[model samples]
Target chain A: MRVRKLIYLLWATAVFLAACGGSGKMEVTNAWGRTSPAAAANGAFYMTITNNTGQDDKLLSASAAACATVELHEMYMRENDVMGMRQVPDGYIPLPKGQTVELKVGGLHVMCINKQQEFMIGDTIPLTLQFEKAGTMEVTAEIRDSAEMPANMPGMQHGGG
Target chain B: MKQLLPLFAFLLLLLAACQSEPKYYGTLWPNPQEVADFTLTGTAGPVSLSDYAGKVVLLYFGYTFCPDVCPGTLADLGYVVRELGRDADKVQVLMITVDPERDTPEQLAEYMSHFHPSFVGLSGTEAEIAAIAAEYGVFYQRHEGTAATGYLVDHTARVFVIDQQGKYWLSFPFGMMREQMKADLQNVLRRG
Candidate 1:
């Protein structure tokens, strides 16, 4: 228990510094993919991207062996009382210097199309995200029943637009 | 300021969360229309809206193949119902598949089991679904996508609530918080 608390304390501090330090690093955290039932044709992943690279960066695309095709998708209110989802028109997500972006449920997400197999809880989806300047970042997203709710940490919550 | 007094009282009542004719967070119809009873194939065979009479019925137009939005809504509803405990029995969540060809009864049932056992998924012929969807102001159309996805359907994502008397009561927009949903449901039950 003490060890866990210490780890939390360390994590809390790291998160705090990331927000205030403006460290020249590209970091991705809280990456998770939603579990897919047997009949589901695709899956989705959400995460938080903290880009303190001191320069603008763009997330171009993502690829994974778990899925044949991956696309950056956005869900929006299309018309009167309707929600519509479409691939990002720009085909990339802009990460301004020192800004944190949250890919959340019912909002911006990574669409994993043509699921090779059903994803169950505890399974991990290894991803290679291509970036404009940050090169490629390898992220392992755990399959979870639901995305984690944005905690009370600073710079963690957004309108999911 | 005579009108202002009533408005002030209404705001106070809302803040107090009084049981006396509480206004729900969902969108209420100016004129509540009675919903047409429709039958669809459920896990236990043909199920009709009237079969769930005397309960607050939430009709969601979606399919099992949906990855982000539908699952988010289902997960939120599951959380809401679970929070209600035994009182959840008075509420029914029905996900009517817009992708009938893909969402067979058995497949939908399996998907709902992942969220909450009490929730039911229903599917029917394309004609049958289109008719029911039209009656409720839901519009859906299939659009071409990648070969892997077969196709994608763009449909209304609102959740329509049917009162115990089978009238269109209120509609919850997508991305509504679970707490708001729970409160609205409790208020409906209380008023009933």
Candidate 2:
């Protein structure tokens, strides 16, 4: 009877631990490359980051071997006549725990300036994203053709053809 | 008799010069073709190709966030529109947003004003933009990656011209000179 009671307690404790786990862990996805190599000199990168650890974490910055400079940028519309995209000097992107923040086209993106290397189809570029609390994470992004869509992540939207 | 012969020879020379002028004498490599019709939400209201009937239309497809091509092309369009003068009203310039999700009708209206007051910006659902792009034989795709931000899109860089009857007329290559575009526009207007 005591052994059975102990087993029940262990199960309850496991459930509690799972429920109390933080929701602010950072996850990155959906990176791609532009088609024209020369045009790739000033290319952009995109992905969705989800923070599940329940703690707010900021995206500090990004580094890549392919470019001399990397910047965070967001596109904004001004009046009824013009649209502009500018660099975000603040290296960090804030994410509330459990919520997903998306950096997409016509929105926020990572701009690779004066790329040192050309990205071709089937090639891969290494990207390292520094986060405030979660430290830094590395990802290898596949260079896709200009017409290929990012796999999964159906909620994402694309503009311009 | 000699004086009469000289007069006849001069008249013949004038006639020959006039006849030697060809019916058309412009570059013909960048010919126009038909583009598919698609619906999108315009700055003023919902717009379709049919709505701009009887006018020469300069159509460009781009997203607001594009740092280089979008603004550069619009600036060029602004110059062309200004050069049109009194005929500007007869020519409709349409800027279609490829990034419709973020570029709402309100956003499009604001974005259009930066280039020119007469420029019309349009956006709509994914399917709507896709259908229109397909009709024009435009190709685009979203790039996925491992950055903290989402993906970017790569698309064809071509401008389309439509005649008064709403038929595809011609295509301008990327970075087409303003003088050439103006000449093309004048020719289309004159033809109509």
Candidate 3:
């Protein structure tokens, strides 16, 4: 009877956890980065962040030991199809409650400039992300070749032109 | 009246076939622009459009500091050329820098070499660059940034295909497919 009762309690806990959401906190996933070309002084990283909390949060900054500086930037096009990439002015990206924020190519991204080490395919770079409410968290971004990435990523793999 | 009906049906079929002809990947200019010869300094010293007299030119405007857009566009072009294989030698890519103050001829060349060894980077005096840009219908401007971040340049991202005869052939808008471009380039080569 005690064993059966324990089993019931375990099942209840599993259900409770599921009801609360798989990860009821700020979480990062799909963390990936691109390898820097030989003459490239900079590299880029991308990922998706999910805010599974009831309160809003803000990503204040990011840091990588491999780079001299890490800046949040966006790639956009002006009128007449003029393309521009610039740093995010406020230096913070908002994370609304229960929403997911994606950082992808040609969109929001993390720019690692003046790299101390080259970002190569299959290598992992350690990054630290700071948030207003969620505090700081460290994540690893797996470096990938452009060919291995998606069409929207740094690699442009498409039908031959 | 019976004879006229059959003639009209045949005409309709011919029109449909014409419309079905494979479309070029890039936008075909209604009136292709005629490009004038221009000279600029590259890593290997003075270079001119006239130098590649009988070769097709893939012209683009960008800068080295551009981490995403420029590299992505160039990579797509590299793939297109690679798809051409032996025919790639008949084509040349010229990347003109919009940020003259920062992108010297040497810097531009070094940056471009990362994309494709055959790619060449061009830089010239402010007036010289402007004249060439104007002729190509390219517009560009700079945006300020932090001291550490330097600045950003916004410029036209279209790819211009200049035929071997030095005439503007087509404009490939940003985000065009490589396969479509390859098909069009193949047709261009076949004509020659």
Candidate 4:
């Protein structure tokens, strides 16, 4: 009976990991980048990072050959009704154990500054993300336009899409 | 149980009625009040708020150098104006730059054209712009940046809507969806 119980627990753990799309130490999914608007030189990239490991992980930095520089930044609402954005000063994004962090539009994102090439639709942007515990993981973010962005984020109520 | 069914139906109807009330995504002002008139330099020449007396004006505050929020707001406005279709003719978009020191009238105009050909960009002296912003309750402050990253400005992001009668009608918060804006604009056009 004890062996059977242990087997059941292991199966349940597998099911939970599968449900969360977490395979190993860290899983990055739904990675995408936005094409710059007309005449704009800079663009942004977004993705979801799920920490599946037992230990907490920190995203130290990111790099891409497509841009001169890549920085982790956050878009936050400031006082006096201002919308503010700046590079994360500490230079690391935290991913706690078993937590999923989303880097999306109008929130946390990767700033692709002074691009060497244009980010067009259907293009795949190769990015190397460095994590403290998980080490370096390469990701490819699909380039999409603003119209293709999902509006289902909480508190986003725009009509006439 | 049979009698309770009517009570439940009545309660559901009341809930539906409450939800049916015309909902506005933006902050609804109590009444339409005269917008503080101001004159600023446009691409062509001097422009005044009163010049758009018969049109609905959507005003946004930001700079051309803003990579994210400003552009996002402009894109939202473009979506709104384009969604309005023919009624778009009656709607005007004006982007007032907070960084007038660098954003000349010509630069503002050129940037506005990239978003929408009909969009107008306005700029003025630092004091002039400050006065206008203060009157509209917009607070802005500059944040210095390193050599690689240029300086940034933190300013109000709400879109103020001026009705056709040239009165301040409503103020839409940042992230207010395009569909709600379209509906409000349609209602305004219909009323006009």
Candidate 5:
């Protein structure tokens, strides 16, 4: 009985720690970066944001030391074959209660422009995402090694194909 | 009358099977036309379409500074090429710079090397690129971007497949699957 009670307490503590980000409301995971060539002026990163705030929240902005600045960007198909990208006009990504929002390539991404350093293969770049309720959370975006890069090639969507 | 209808349907099926034309994943030009021979600078100076006469070529219009869509498309093309195994050499993926001022021939070479060794990047003067782009139905325009990114270029991201005889064949739009691409390429390779 004593051993079982201890196990339950440990589990509860672990959950408490995880749910205690910012105002104790969000979890960020699967942050990854695309490989940046030596002379590339910009780099892109993607990740997932889970809102546990029990209320709707918004991601207002983001930043990273690896680049001079960053913006929450999205890609949309302008025509049958042309794709255009721009900053999220509403200025924030919506994170509804109990839902996970994914930022992906050819869709939503963190566009790090004016690179201060090259994100070579197998390196990590620290990204600071600012949320309305969650405050600021830093996530490491790892550029995977060549042999094991995730097959992130996905289709583009929104505003027509 | 029912018996006759069944015979009629069987005959139609047989006829349809015999007359089926070759299929491709991307949209085919209504009237495939021969593209004019054009020259652009490669890592090795002054390369032309005629250089790879008998091989299939995939042409792309993109810039090195483009962080998302361009590389995603290139990675898909690279996946198709690599999956072809030894036959990969029969095909080529060439990227022409939409931002010629930004993408140097050396930078293009290094960028292409990352996708696949056989992938090639081309550069030329602004006038030269514009002329070629106009003829090929690829369009690009310069514009101001956010403070983070100094500028951006909006361009059509279709991959045009040029056959061995130098005719503009099917064009693959952005986000085409590698399997479909591979199947279409194999069909082109076999038919030629």
Candidate 6:
């Protein structure tokens, strides 16, 4: 009986570690993509990254076959009040344990440049997100129309054009 | 049929008489104030607000990196400018880039060309941009991060109008109609 109890305790510990730190345990939610028409030539993708582990992890990089290059970017406003945006260097995004990070309009975003093919609504673009510890996870982002409001940003107006 | 023709002619005459009178479509914004004079770099060269003293001026503040709102507003302004025709010469459209760090004069020139040649693009140092934005009561904020790239900037989306005397006249919110803008310009010019 003592031996059996010890085995059960060891198994439970292994299961808990596997659930907290392993690649299969991390969670991602609210992924989306927008592809312009063939003529527009540029598109953007957005999503939220959630880290479920007790330990922190980092998002190393991302890749997609749909575009010539995939870049991470964020817009900036200076103390003097000018606004600008530039590409993120290193492409490593930090994710704290049990926290959620969002990429949306007027915020951190992923830019897909020089599209080889156009993405239309109701279609999905296959992407792979590389993490420092989570290895690589495959994701499919749904293409949305330009007029579509992001589900995360409530009270945002539409049909401004 | 012959008896009805005379009645129709009388109705047409009455309509023509009524059309000769100008219709005042309600005020744009109540209690409008005049915009102050300020100097900034333009696509052509250094230009002051006073340079457009005698013309109706449409002024909007935005940055080049804005993916949607800036371009859409400029496109609409281009359409309205074209609709004005010869009167377009009587009006000035000013686009002030809120992002001065990257929007050099050359960049401003290139970006303005994407919409209309007649439209003017302006950029200046952070201090200058902030001073003008404050004077205009525009609000903007920048998010900070260690991404080695820039952060995001959120800003107000109000377009201001200046009358012939360089005084703040009215304001158009986002998605204003071109016809409404044309009418407002005509009204301002007539008042002058």
Best by TM-score: 3
Cα lDDT tens digits for candidate 1, B1-192? 997999999899887775345657777776888888999999789999999999989899998767898887788888888888878899899999999988889889988877888889999999999999999889887777655666777888788888888888688777666777788888777767
Per-residue lDDT of B84 in model 3:
92
CA displacement after TM-score superposition, residue A39 of candidate 3 (Å): 3.6
Per-residue lDDT for B1-192 in model 4, tens only?
999999999999999997563556677766668888899999789999998889999998988766666766777787789988888889999989998987888878877776678999999999999998887789888887534456767788888888888888577777667787788888777667
Q: Write the per-residue lDDT of candidate 2 for residues B1-192, one digit (tens) a residue.
A: 988998999999999987652322222324455555666787567788777878888888876545444654566667777898988888888877777765677766666665678778888888988888887767666554225324455565567778787767465554455666677777777777
For residues B49-137, could you state the per-residue lDDT of candidate 3 as single tens digits?
99998888999998877766677678778778888989999999999889888888877877776667899999988899999999877
Candidate 1 regions off by >4 Å?
A: A1-23, A117-124, A147-161, B1-20
**Candidate number of the best DockQ:** 3
Error of 2 at B58 (Å): 1.0
First chain TM-score for all predictions = 0.77, 0.79, 0.76, 0.76, 0.74, 0.74
Q: Poorest 10 consecutive residues of model 1 chain B by lDDT?
A: B16-25
**DockQ class, candidate 6:** incorrect
- The CAPRI classification for model 1 reads as acceptable
- When 2 and 6 are scored with lDDT, the better candidate is 6
DockQ of 3: 0.36
Candidate 6: residue A81 Cα off by (Å)? 16
Across residues A1-161, which tens digit of lDDT does each residue of candidate 5 receive? Answer: 99999999999888886676424568899888877666677778889888887778999999988887888888776665677777887868889988999888777888888888767767988889999977899889988422223242345321111
Q: DockQ values for all predictions?
A: 0.23, 0.02, 0.36, 0.14, 0.31, 0.06
The RMSD of every model to the true structure, in order and in angstroms, is 9.2, 19.6, 4.3, 7.9, 5.5, 11.5
Question: Please, what is the TM-score per model?
Answer: 0.80, 0.48, 0.83, 0.77, 0.81, 0.52
Evaluated at residue A137, the lDDT of candidate 1 is: 94
- For model 6, what is the error of residue A154's alpha carbon versus the real structure, in angstroms, after optimal superposition? 12
Compose the digit string of candidate 4's lDDT tens values, residues A42-128.
567899998987678899889999877787888777765677777877878999988999887678888777677756668999999
Model 5 misplaced regions, further than 4 Å: A1-24, A116-122, A144-161, B1-19
